[model samples]
Target: MENQAFQIGKASLLTKQSMGEPKQLTSSIVILVLATNIVYISNMLNLVTYLHDRMHADIASSSTMVTNFVGATCAFALLGGFLSDSYISRFKTMLIFGPIEFLGLASLALQAHLPSLQPPKCDTVNEWNSCKKMSNLDASILYLSLYTVALGEGCLRSSMASFGGDQFDENDPIESQQKSSFFNWYTFDKSLGGLLGLIFIVRIENNKGWDYGFGVSALVILFGLVSVASSFSFYRIQRPRGSPLTRLLQVIVAAFKKRKLSLPENTDDLHQLDIKEETFGMEVLSHASGLEFLDKAAISHGSTGAWSLSTVSQVEETKIIIRMLPIFLSSLSCYICNPLLVIFTVQQGNTMNTKLGKIHISPTSLVIIPLTFQIIFLVLYDSLFTPFARKFIGYRTGITQLQRISVGIISMSLGMCVAALVERKRKRVA
Candidate 1:
C-alpha cells in the first residue's frame, strides 16, 4: 500500500461540533492514565513475589521469570508502534490491546485463586523434595497468561502517550504551548497512579492475597478502557502514515541504488514532495546538513519508483535516525541491570524488621521512597534548575536531551552502587 503521508504529517481535524477539544481530550487521557498506570505499576512491582509465593518459583527463578516477562512486554511495543502507524489509528490500537490485557489479568486471577491451578505450597519445595514444584502444565498456563498480558500492555504503552499528544494542533500557538505542558501533566498523572499503586495496592496484596490484587488490576484496566471509549467521539485521531521503518529502509535502498550518481551543485535540485502531493498533507522536512552520502537517494534517477528514488525529507529522516543510534544503544546499559534492584529490595525487605507500630509494611511499598524523590526532582528541575542552568547553557528544556540522559545514567549507576553497599552490609550483619 502507498504511504498515507509520513508520520501524521497533517491531521484533518475530524470531530463532532462540540467534541475533540483539548479540554475533553485532556480529561479523558487523565482518567485513562490513572486507571492504566496504577495497576501496571502494582503488577510490575509485585510480579516476582507473586511468581515465587503463589506460583512456587524460587527467588532466582522468580526474578528471571519477571525480568523476561517485563522484557517481552517492552519488546511487543514494536508491534504497537508498527500497527498504530501502518494499519490502525492509535485510539483503535488502545481499544484492541486494552481488552487483551484485561483477559490476561483475569486469567492470572483465576489461576492464583484456584488451588488446582497452583503448585502444592510447602516448607521446602526443592530442598529435600518435600513437595513437588509447579507442574509443567501449570507453568505453561502461567507463561501463556503472562505473555498475553505483556502483548496487551506493550502495545498500549506505545500508543497512549502519543495519542494524547495528537490531540493538540501543533501549528496553533496556544495549543502548541499547551502541548508542551501536556507531557508534564502526563508524567504527573502517571506518577500519581504509580504512587497510589505502590502505597495502597501493594498493601492490599500483602494483607489480602495475590488473587485480590490481580482481580483489582483487571478491573482498573477495564475502567481505563471505558474512559477511553467515553470520549471516543472527542479524539482527533491520528491518520496512519505507513511504517516509518519502511520509509527508512526505502531511503537506504534508494541511496544504494543511486550510489554512482554525482552530488548536485545546489541542494534545491534534490526532490521533495511533488507539488500536487505537497498540497495534500505530506510532511515537508527540509534537507539537513551532514550524511551527504544518503542524499544520493534524492537525485533525479531514470525510474520514478519509490525504491529507485526517495524524497530529500525522507533521506533526512534516515540521517536523523542514524545520528541518534548511539543514544538508543547506550540506553540499554542504563536500564539492563537496574530492574534487578527491585527484586533484591523486595527480598531484603522481607528479611528486615518491617513493623511500624501496628502497621505491617509491604516490601514492594518501598517504591514510594523513590517515587516521592522523582516527583520532587521533577518539580525542582522545572522550577529551580531550569532557571539556574539557563544562565550557563541555554536551551528551552534548560539542557539538551543528551545531557539529561547522561545525568540519568550516572544517577542510576550511583543508586546501584549504594544498593550494593547496603546489601553487603546487611549480609555481614546477618
Candidate 2:
C-alpha cells in the first residue's frame, strides 16, 4: 500500500511539472509581441509625418497633429494605469485595448487618401479661420480615432510591463535571472521591429503611397495581435494592488474623528483594525476596510473608521500622480525630437540630395540610421558598460536605476544636439 501511494504521488508531481513549461513559454511570447507594437507605431509616426509633408501641410499644422496625438496619449495613459491597477487583469486589459489600437490604425489608413473622411487639408493660411465652415464630424472622427488608439496603448503599456515582471517567481533565483534576460532581449526585439518599420514601411510610403504605408502598419499590428492571442492560454492572471483612493479617504475621516474626539493623547482606549500598505491595496486592504467602514457607517452614520480609508486613499492618489509625472516628462522630451528626425531626413532626401548630387534617397531611409545606432548603443550599454560598471562600481556602491537613467538622458540630449547641428548644415547647403 505504501509503495502504491508513492508511485501515485510521483505521477501527479510529474504531470504538474510537464504542464507548466508550455504556459510559461506562451506568456513570454505574448509579452514579446506586445512590445513589438511600440516600434511599429513609432516607425509609423515617421511615415505619417513624411506623408503630411508630401500632402503640403504647413510646418505648424504638421507639428500640431503629432503634438495633439501625443497629448491625447498622455491623457489616456493615466486613465489606463488606474484601470489596470484596479478592475481589469493585465491580460484582459490587453485583449480589450489591443483591438482599439487596431481600429485606430485602420481609420488612419482608410482616411489617408479620402480627404472627406478627414479634417480639411492644413495647407491654407489661417486654416483655423475657416474652421467654423467645416463640419465637426470629420475632425471629431479623427480625434476620436486617435484617442481610441491612445486609450488602448495607455492601458496596455504599463500593465504589460508589470505583467512581464510578474511572470518570474522572485523566490526562484534561476527564474529571476531569466526575467532580467527577458527584459534585455525584449527591448532588443522592440528596436528590431522599429528597424523593420523604418526600412520597409518608409520605403513603401516613398514608393507606393501614404495610404499603403499606413495600411502596412495596420497589418503589422494585426499580426502582433494574432501572435499575442495565440499565447493567451499561457498567461497567469495577477490581481491589482490596493485602492489608494479608498485608503486616502479613510485617512481623511480618521483625521476628522481624531480632531473631533479630542480624546486623551495616546488613547489606548480605542481599538480598531489598522490597515497596512500592501501590493494589491485595492484588492486586499480597500476591500476589507471599505466593507468595515460601510458596516460602521450603516450603524453609526458617522466617521465609522472611514477616516483612515480617506487618508490612505488620498496618499495613494498623490503617489500615483507623482509616479506618472516622470513618464510624461520623458515621453514629452522624446517626442519633441521624434518628428524633427523625420523632417531632417526629408530635407536630406530633397535639397541635401540635390546639392550632393547623390543617388535617390528617401527621407524614410534615413530613419534606419538612428534605429541602427540605437540597437548598437543598447547592446553596448548592456554588455560592455553595464558589466564594467558592475565590476567597478557594483563592488563599491552597486548599479542603480537613477544612475542609468541620468546617463541615458544626458546621452540623448547630446545626440539631439548633434542632430540639430547636422540639420543646420543640411539647411545651409539647401
Instruction: Specify the highest-lDDT model's number.
Output: 1
User: TM-score per candidate, in order?
Assistant: 0.88, 0.69
Reference-based lDDT, each prediction: 0.80, 0.56
Q: Give the TM-score comparing model 2 with the true structure, all chains together.
A: 0.69
Clashes within 3 Å, all models in order: 0, 35
Q: How do the residues 1-430 of candidate 2 rate in per-residue lDDT, one tens digit apiece? A: 1111101111231222333442365455544454445434454456345434444444556556656666666677667667766786666677778788778777767876687765455544345344323346655665666677677666666566666665555445556556655665566666666677666776776678767876777677677667767765454445655444545455445554444343323322233334555342232222222223222221222444544323333433444545667865875665577556645455455444433365654555556576778778778767777668768875321256556566667777998888779878876876
Q: What's the residue-level lDDT of 309 in candidate 1?
A: 88
Query: Which candidate wins on TM-score?
Result: 1
- Residue-wise C-alpha lDDT for candidate 1, range 1-430, written one tens digit per residue: 1122223213444333434457667787778788778988778888888777667677889988878888898899999999998898888899999999999999988988898988876665355255567898899889999999999999999898899888776766657656756776788778788888887677778778878988998998999899888877556776778777988999899999889889899999998886568533446789888989899999997997888888987898889899889999887887776477557777788788778899877788777777778777777776788668867775555677688889988888888889889889999987
Error of 2 at 40 (Å): 4.4
